[model samples]
Target: MKPLDPRLLRYARGTRVYLAATVALGVVLAALIVAQATLLAHGITAVFLDGADVRTLTPTLIALATVVAGRAAVAWAQETVAVRSSAAVKSELRGRLLAHLVAVGPARGGDTGAVTTLITRGLDALDAYFARYLPQLVLAALVPAVVLARLLPADLTATMTIALTLPLIPIFMALVGLHTEAANHRQFRLLSRLSHHFLDVVAGLTTLKVFGRAGAQAATIRRISAEQRRLTMRTLRVAFLSSLVLELLATLSVALVAVGIGLRLVSGHLDLTTALLVLILAPEAYLPLRQVGAHYHASAEGLAAAEEAFAILETPVPARGAAPAPAGTIVFDDVVVRYRDRDALHLSATVEPGEIMALTGPSGCGKSTALDVLLGFVTPDHGRVTVGGVDLASVDPAAWRSTIAWVPQRPYLFAGSIRDNIALGRTPMHLPEPPTAFAHCFTGTVPDAPRPDVAAAARLAGAAGFIAGLPDGYDAALGDDGAGLSAGQRQRIALARAFLRDAPIVLLDEPTANLDTETAADVMAAIRRLAHGRTVIIAAHRPELIALADRIVDLAPQPVGAR
Candidate 1:
């Protein structure tokens, strides 16, 4: 990726504002540089050559100090704006990336660990890019020209020398940047792999210990970590080498201009003030370029990550329709879903309003695919789905989804109070017993405030009994994935959430997968209550659960070309 990739502007919001601000700041900084250098030169010459006393140089000293203060203020403002702009860009990119991931769905096969690392650490790397590199890039473009223009009036020979030697720094930078960019990209990829492997192993650590392969996995992790370390060192080495080259080139350029100014001063052809001014401005001419090269290495990783983010943003999302989904029946007319190199499902089914339908199939027989299609996550390769004679393709996805509630095989429970998990932080209208009321009634201790709708829904799902028995009642905090709750308890909570949703359609996937006989029975009772007055579709195999369905559709795996 280029040091300042154009794609960032396309993917991250507020980039143009940052660029414009950077340019304005760079111009201000350049003007300050010229003023400060001029003032300092005149002050020094007045004191040393013109034999001016301290009192005579007081005004020059004050003006130089003021110009110095102005330069400092400009630098401070530049940094403050850069920090804010970086934050805004990162926020915008993260939001867009997550939304796109949802739109594309799981069929896109994104790695969870990779995506997490990208959004968190990878995007953070952009701080260096925005806060340091981008501003330097703007300064490099503006400062050198401004400084050189000022030098031309002081000493033409020195200005000409600066112009001739300045090109070498960028020529060297371009060559070093090519190598640095490649090294940074490789390092980023390795970092992503390391993150993914670590997360995968940690998530399955229990399984590894059970199979007595934990020791082997530890060795694998060590090996991967060592490899990542080695690559990191190599990348750092290249970055250091690039920085060294740019520093050397800049120093040489400044030295050349200084030598020309000194020779002219010795020949009496140049005044002391002009020589001093040219000498001061000579280094300033190359300072921005050197800083740009230095910051480029720091920002290389972020640039690589930004490139990946843009690739995802550029992917086409499934087109959503404009019409609202109608009420009545959802018809899958000879629908077919094909995964690359394989056909996952083919079906002709109709789910009528206010009726329950069960989808039964063996593993890998596309039971889930059918559900995904219905949920608008996947599009059929052939035929179409319609609701009340209106094609699903003609119905807006968000509008269509608003009418349905879904419970997956494994319900995800975020770490929060029971009420927050159930309501997912949204305020519901229904009122029931408050958490304090439930606590007083069941545990004899008044606790936190309650979510009435959460309690009412839990009662309907038969989860209120367990929730009420807890020390904090509905106010209890649970760990990730409901660590303190049994599988049946979690299922009941999911059912309660579905009940609270009170949508026109409900879809359940293996609602009783990990439940015991008694718990399953309780969940089934809840399901029956939830199914009442709603169109329900269940992907289930349990006889009792299947029996509740008004109709059962069994799916079988079909060949690639099967009709």
Candidate 2:
């Protein structure tokens, strides 16, 4: 990305304000720099050339001090604003990225480790872009013009010399930047791969140990880590080289301007004050440009990640309508879902309100795809789904989702108290007890307390018994994904959330697939109770769950060549 990519302004809100403020501060800073230079030159000339005493130069001394202070204040403010803006931009980008990922669903291929790194470490790289690169970019444009305007009236020769040579810095910067950007891109890709590989190995460490391959995997990790280190060193080398080139060009340009001013001073054609001012201000003109080059190298990785994030955000989402979904029967008429060249599901079915409907099929028969359709996560390629004669496509997705509750095969438990987990979707509340050490593992705020109706929902889901037996009842904190809880306990917590949601439609995807027999029986009982007076759809192969369905819809696997 360039110093200021248009996409940042387009995708992140409030960036325009930051840019405008930076420009305004740059202008103020330029004025202070010029004033300080003029005062310093005048004070030195008055004392040395005119033989003026301290009493005579006191006002000049005070004015110079004020100008210096003003410059410092402006620099501090610019830095403060840039830091805040970087934070805001990252927050906004992360929010949009997460929302887009959720909308796209997990069926859409994405590496978990890459996405995690992008939102965390990748976005953190933007700090250099906003704090250093963008502020200097503004100064690079404004300070030079302001300094040139001041110098032209004082000495046209010195002004022209600076104008002619200043372009060399940018020329060298651009050439070096081409190489730096490529190296940074490669480094970012390697970091993402390293994160993915390490996470995969860690997650499967138990399996690897069981198969006696953990040592081999450790060697593989070491190799990946070494490669990452090599790439990082390469990127750093390019960055340092670019900075060196920028510094050399800037120093050479300032030296040329200073030589011109010095020769004119010796010839008695230039006044001492003007020559001194020109010499001092000439270097200031090139400083911002050199700084811009330095910051660009630091921020390149963030720019690459931002580019990827923009691509994800720009992917088209299924169009949703404004109409609300009706609380009635849902009909799936010849619905078909295709992935690549294969049809995952091709079937027709109806699920009426207050009925338990079961979808049974072998693995890969699109049982989950059917549930996805109901959840509005997938759009069918052919046929349609309608509720009370209104097309599902025409109903607003958010509105439709608001009327349903869903439980996946593996229910995710956030790090929080038992009560907070049960009241996940409700109003935020203070936790009755402080979170445990394990709560620090997950991202996001854990409610300090639980919602008022958490106990009722827990009772309805048969979770109140175990929860009450805990030391702190609903306030007892659980680890990441409820690590401390039994599978049955976790499922009950999910059921409590569903009961609390009280939506008319309930969808479950193999809720009992991983539970022990006794636990599964308990979950089944909770499911039966929760399905009362609601439209329940279960995608399951287990006879216990299928037997409870008011009607069963068995799906057959598609033929090998079927479209």
Candidate 3:
């Protein structure tokens, strides 16, 4: 990323306001710096050269104190704003990033662990960029120019000297920045790899143990960790060495300006007051630039991570329409999807409303891809899908999806009470209790008073029996991704969700793929109930599941060059 990527300003609205504030503060800080230096120089010259006493120099002392306090106040204000702006910008960027990821869907969203790390720990690094580097950068641009402008009339020679040498700091910074950016990118990549690998190992630890490969996975994780440590140290070493170089250059420049001032004062070519003012302002001119160089290292990793985020956000999403979904028969008209020089799917099918249709295929023959096509996650390279002769592509995806209920082969269940997970975004179903005024009039308890709808849906999906046996029933807290539940239990919960959705169209993918015989029978029974009176599509490999369909469309893998 460049010093200030324009995409950030466009993608994160908070950045626009924050950046404007930063620039305004930079101007205020510049003015305060000049005022402080001018007052201090005059006070010192008054006391030493003019033989002024405390009583006569009281006003000068008072003005100097005021300027100092103003500078301190401005400094505090800048820090407070920086902290708040960092939080707002991160939140805005994170929100945009998550929305874009969802819009693109899972097919093209890349590795789950890598993206998880990026949105969480990855973007957190931006705090240094906003809080430290950006403020100093604004100061570097403003303070030096302000200081030089102040010195031009009082001491033209000092001003020229400062101007000519100041460029040296930035020149060296540019040179060092090129190397530092590459090193930072390398370090971030290793960290991402380490994070991804560790997450994968932990998620599969049980499977690794079953296969007697846990030791091998542990060794792999250790190797990646060691590599990450070495790269981190190396990046830090470069940052430290570059900070030293920038500091040394800035020090030499200030000293050079001081040496010229000293030479002129000795020759009586410069007055003491002017010399002192020039000396004070010269270091102030270099300080912001030097600090920018130092903070640049601190923000480098964050910039690298943001570059990836921008890349993801920039990916083109399949265009959707605003029109409502048309209802009738669903038709797949000679659809063909060619991916990576092989055909992912090719089909021609039709299903009348309220009919059950099954798509059967081998693992790589694109059964799931067919479901994705219906879900609008992927657009076919050729052919069209239509509902009652209206193009599916012309329908608003969200509106169309609202009319459909989908159960993926592996449904994701978030960490929450089971009822919340099942309800997802909708408010929990509840029956209003009798009014408080009539508290004593009821003779029997309200049937399913709290969440009658959820209970009814669970019963329809054959999940009520297991749910009632749980310690907390429907209110049981689930771990991440529905942990602490058996595979059959998870499947039942997903079916319960679909049942609750009650959409006109239902799409199920391998609904009984991993269940035991008895559990599969129960699930199949629920599936029969779910399919009745609904426009249902099932991507199935099991014979019994296929048998339940009104008709089957067998999808065989296409050979290479079969486009």
- Provide the global lDDT of candidate 2 against the true structure: 0.83
Assess the local accuracy of residue 30 in candidate 1 as a C-alpha lDDT between 0 and 100: 98
Give one digit per residue, the lDDT tens place, for model 1 in 326-407. 7888898999999777778888999989999999988788887888888887889998998899999878877777787787
Residue-level lDDT for 182 in candidate 2: 86
Best by TM-score: 3
Clashes of each: 0, 4, 0
CA deviation > 4 Å runs, candidate 2 = 91-115, 189-225, 261-272, 340-344, 352-357, 360-365, 425-465, 499-504, 528-534, 541-557, 560-563
* Candidate 1: clashing pairs of residues: none
Model 1 sits at a Cα RMSD from the real structure of 5.7
TM-scores for candidates 1 onward, in order: 0.85, 0.83, 0.90
Candidates ranked, most accurate by TM-score first: 3, 1, 2
Model 3: what TM-score? 0.90
Against the reference, the lDDT scores of all candidates come to 0.83, 0.83, 0.83
